[model samples]
Structure formats: C-alpha cells, structure tokens
Target: MDSITFRSDTVLSDVHMYTPNIRHLMVRLNAVGQPVFVSKFRILRNINVCSKDDIGDLGNEENRELVGVNNASTSRVDCSNTMANEKKDEEKKETAATEILLDDDGDLDVPRRPSDFVNSCEKDLWREKVYPTIISKGEEVPFEEYDEDWSICNDIRIEHTMDTTLEDVGKQIWRGAFLLADYILNNTYLFRGSTVLELGAGTGLTSIVMATVAKTIFCTDVGEDLMNMCERNIIVNKHIYGAAGGEIKVRELDWLRDDLCTDTKNPYCWSEEEIAHLYDYTNVLLAADVFYDDDLTDAFFQTMYRILSNLKNRSITYLSVEKRLNFTLRKMDVTCDAYDHFRLCLADLESINDGKTKFIVEAIKLTFPQFLFYERVEQLELWKIIAEPLISNTQQ
Candidate 1:
C-alpha cells in the first residue's frame, strides 16, 4: 500500500466536530498499480473512548512505597494522555470533513434532518421582529412602507413620511384598506387579470396588495406630492410585481376636479380614450377612508356614479369609511348640513331609477386603546354597490 498522511489541520478543523449520535471517518488510499487517481473509503459508527484505570488503591502502603516511581510514571502518563487527546481531536475533525464532502457529493446515504430547536428559534424571531414591525401598523400608513421588510405578492408599492398636513391627509393609508384587501384576497376572486382603480388610495397599501393580484392597478390620490410619493413606492417594489406579471401606476386623481374626468386640453386630465379604457378593463373599484369630510361627499358620489355607469360589465365597488359621529354633529351644527346634502344626492339618484342600483352597507367596529388612540374613534362601514345602467330598473 502506498502511504499518504492527510494533514489533520487542512480538513478536520473546518468541519462540525460537536455533532453527536454519529461519527464519520474518511480515508484516501493510493495504489501503485492502479490507473485511477485515488480511491476513497468512508466509515460511520456510534462509538466512544473511555479510560480503564483503578484508583481505589491510592492510599495503600505498597502504593506509598511506589509513589516516587509512580509520580515519574504519572508525568509520562499525562504527556501520553495529552497526545492521545490531540490525536483523537484531529481524527474527529478529519471524520467530520469527510462526512461533509460525502454529503455534498451525494455519496453519503444518511438522511440529514434539521434540528427542531433551530426551526422554533427562527419562527420566534419572525414573530417578534417581523409581525409588529411590518404587518400590524394601521391603514393610514400605506402597505408600501413595509415593502423592504416584507415580500409583497403584487407590484404595488408605498412610500410614507412623518409629515402630517391637511393637504396631505389623502396620502395617508387607513387601516381599513388593509382589511379590505385582506377580505378581497381571502373571500373574493375579483382581482386576477383585471385592471383595478383605487380612489383616495392614501399610502396605496390596498393598491399595492391589489397590484399583486390584479393584472394592473392604478393608484390615485388627490395631491401632487402624494401621487409622487405613490409613484416612488411603486418604483421601489417594481421588481416584486415584475416577478408576478403585474403592473401598477400611481397618478393624481382629485375627486373635486371636474376637469380631471373630461378635460382634453390637459395631458394629466382623464381623456376620453382613458375613460373608455378604464370602462373596458376596470371590473372593481376600491376606496378606503374617503367619507370623513362631509364637504366632498356629493362630488365623491357623483364621480363614483359616472365611473360605474360607464363600465360595460357589472362592476363591484368597495367603499370603506369610518362613520365619524363628530363629522355628523359638525355638519348638523353648520348651516351647510353635510349629511343632508349627502342624503339629498342619494335620494335624487334613487328617484331617477326607483332604487334600481343596489347598495349594501355593513358597520365594522375596530378595537383600540384610549391612550394610544391617534386614529379617530369611529365605526367602519363597508359598502358594496352594484351599478345599474338605468335607474328605473334598479332595485331599492
């Protein structure tokens, strides 16, 4: 046999040495007559080494007489023991390396399993840092804010800032949008291969989620800055949607601007072609936290009516609002009577069609503590409305 010393330092130190229950050894042999480069051998077992020495006679007189010679012998024994331990360690390291190599090469027939403790630790880490930091934040902050920390299935993205201003109020994503998106994802099959339009899409969280599920999503907010931010968020998560074969566009859509829906002179305005395209592809309309201001209620409903009327196919409109008592009271206190204005608009629409269009509203109560209460305390109402071509044939 040709002899070769496999250096213990090169292979043994890099392998896992503390793994219990099994031991592995690798041997490489070279034959003078063999035509091949090398031959490899592997051995695996469950074995341990132990010392067998008697120590009960340490206090005997005969032992005392032999103590001097015993002491010298003790030193030699200690040296030998140390050498033996070093040799064993080297051997173990080599064995570990061999096991790893064999496993990598698919030559090791042992089934490797992950330790349960490691998996549990990973789960605990995700629950502790990922859930509270990313998933639990309310709707006012768009879902895009958590893009970097979490993976979104669609192309939708969000950008957020700490800046709070009246003009930028429409930029904030409400928690209700998250709930709406979750509901749609879990219960409805309305998103696939569809073009979706999200009105008053604050941080565009719902749009982001919808973008993941829809063929295309158009996320709109009222302000220029908010629209820019929405676009920025979309760019940030562009890759995510690309991978999923979906797309998202963030644009400014002012419900108060009548020109937005009709002006042909302005490029940013909703042109006739765009309107036709919207009517053709859009099957679902989503809105969240849009009913807070009583002043915009009429214009909001009119816009919704026009959009719904144009769709050739039946469209499902999901509108969520936090029913604020303060707003109702404020409108009542004011001479304008905002609720009355809204009711009058609804009544007018109802009178024209004899309630041909269908509206279903359900109130959802949200839980929050008083001290941490930043969002207005209000009951959320989700409305599912079906638009009818003619008001006369609509069901009440």
Candidate 2:
C-alpha cells in the first residue's frame, strides 16, 4: 500500500521529499537489495498529519507498509480468531443501524448514511471513536526471518484511526510499548511479585503484559478519557494477563507541571493519599517512547527524580526509546532533544563523575532473548535507572 503520501508543493530531491504540510519528513528508498546512496536519513514522525486538532507525536508510526508486506501465508501474528469475532460484531451493528432508519420517524425507501443515524441508543451513537484492528497479534519477538515457536503470545487491541489531541495518543499501542513489554516478558523473574508503575501507558499494552507477571501495576496517564480507554483494555483482557494474579489500576499523572516535589502541602503536588496507595508500593518504573521532545523530556526526568528522591528504598526504572533523527535537504540533521537531555540528567547522577548521592543511570547490555514479535523500529534502545545499586555500574 504505497499510501505514504506527500505534500504536492514541498521541495523534493532524488532520495528525499519534504512535506511542510505535515511535521514529519518522508524519504523514498531504493529497492530491498539495492545499495542506495543518500546524504542522510532519519525516522522523523509527522505529528500533525492525520490529527489536525492534536499536538505531539506518536510511536509505531502506522507502518501499514510492514503489516501488509509480510506474506499472508506465513505471517506469525495469527489474526484468525480476532477477525471472526469482529466480522460478527460488525454485522450486528450494521443490522441495527439499518433498522433505526426504517422507523416511523422517516421514509423507509432510502439508504441512510451513518451520519443520518439519529435517536440511536447510547451504544450506537456515532461519537468520535476508532475501530479495532488485528495488527500483530502478540507473538514472541521474532529474532530472524525464520524464528518460530514463541513461548508467550499476547493479543493486542488498537485503534485504526485516532484523534491527535494530546490525550488521543493513548488510543493505540506504540512500538515502544511492545518493546518494553517484550523486555518484561523476557525478564519475568525481576518483576515477579514487584509493584510496577507505568508512565504514559498509552492503551495499557505494556501494563497489560506486566500485569501478567508483576504483583500489581498502576497504569497512569493524563486525562479521564485516556484512563478510561486504558482501563477498558485492561478489563477486556483480564482473562489473559489480568489472571496472572495481579491487578491493574488507572490514575491521572500530569507530568508537565513543576509540582513533582515531595511536599504534600501543595495541592498541585502529588497527594499524600496517592503516594500511600500507589507510589508507596512501587519499586520499579516503566516508560516507553515517552522521550519525544525537549519539554516532555525535562518534565519526565523531573517526575522520575522526584519519585526516586522521595523513596527510602532504592528503585529501578527501565526506559526504552528510539532516537528519531530529522535529516533535511540542507544536510542538517535534527534529532530528538529528549535523548540528549536524558543523557545529561543521567550523567549528573553518576557517583564518581558528579559525586552526587542520588540515583544512578546505567546502560544494561542485554542481547539475549530477542523479542521479534513486534517490528523492531529504528535505533530502539533500552536504559536502566537505579536509585542505589548494590554493585557499582561498571557499564556506566
């Protein structure tokens, strides 16, 4: 599906195309086996393309190309059961919609469009919503083209189209969520019986997988609508991961504020009740693809620092991100600023380098158990953050 559309009026080169109409850039690549030469390439997400009213970018990038590119006969993600249930559900909705238009309120001979659906029950109301698609039903992360027989499988639910408001990002499960979830599944022992808190847990995909192994999971984001969607997915999939003998609870955590201090007196700060109920039990933190821009990067680290500093016992945070570089025709490559800011914040906490009795950030070299289930996007990396490691992090 060469649907990778571009703005008609933007500047174009032999290998690159600029679409100022959207925030993301697009590059036309050579064939799979050809050795193509280009000045540079970057995985820049065009945030404002589909979501006109929304701000901020998303992950996984609707790589519809990869989805349909895989041979249908040998694809790993089995969507048979998923499609059957959906077909039946759609049929029911279509039938009910047809009946609504034939009622005494209007003429019966005309075919009514969906917008013509009036007096619908709450369930049938056409609110701004997204339909679920069967992209990548959870399989073991594939190692090579031929790897098979994955031990664990997760069926994920995601939206086909979503609004781009800051809150709407929670509608779909991004690639970062899949990568982090794969890490948790591979490192299941570390999370056993531990309380895990997920920040920016869009759609609760990562939390859903973590819930399968951890004692408890607090799925948090910014808005009520997003939290409701997250909670709905958790509840809908309870039998699969929820039955892993853990519970998933949703909460609102706006990380943009400067109120991440330990002071309980300030109303803007985290409430004492929230700390006692949720944060107190948390010993591990999880975030994926949360580092997209500069402001978000600073606030995210501040939230992490506030929590690590307030805690009496040492805790560890696992952050997974893909460094997105923006390469332009002028040979100027712009990268996500969050990556640099995170490095600065982590370096300042190094005991030997900065001499601060604070949290330490280290890069863990983990190459085993490659999760080939989800599409491994460009330059994805995993970092480890610990408040106080029992052993010195020589890797740092």
Best by lDDT: 2
Q: Give the TM-score comparing model 1 with the true structure, all chains together.
A: 0.50
TM-score of each: 0.50, 0.55
Per-residue lDDT of model 2, residues 217-316, tens digit only:
8777775545655665676556556557988777667788645334544322345575665545678899987876668777887787666655545678
Q: Report the error of model 2 at residue 361, Å.
A: 1.5
Range of the 10 consecutive residues with the lowest summed lDDT in candidate 2: 34-43
What is the C-alpha lDDT profile of model 1 across 1-396, one tens digit per residue? 232223333221101112110111111111211110100111111101101122113234342222111010111112245544644553443333223322333332221222232343344332211011122222233334332333332223233432134454544445466456654554435678888788888766667667656887767776555565566556655554566577876655777875453544433356566666676778788887666456677778877776676666666777765543333454564343444454465556545553334443333333311111012223444556655544432231
In model 1, where do residues sit more than 4 Å from their true spots? 1-157, 261-273, 327-378, 390-396
The C-alpha local distance difference test score for the whole of candidate 2 amounts to 0.50
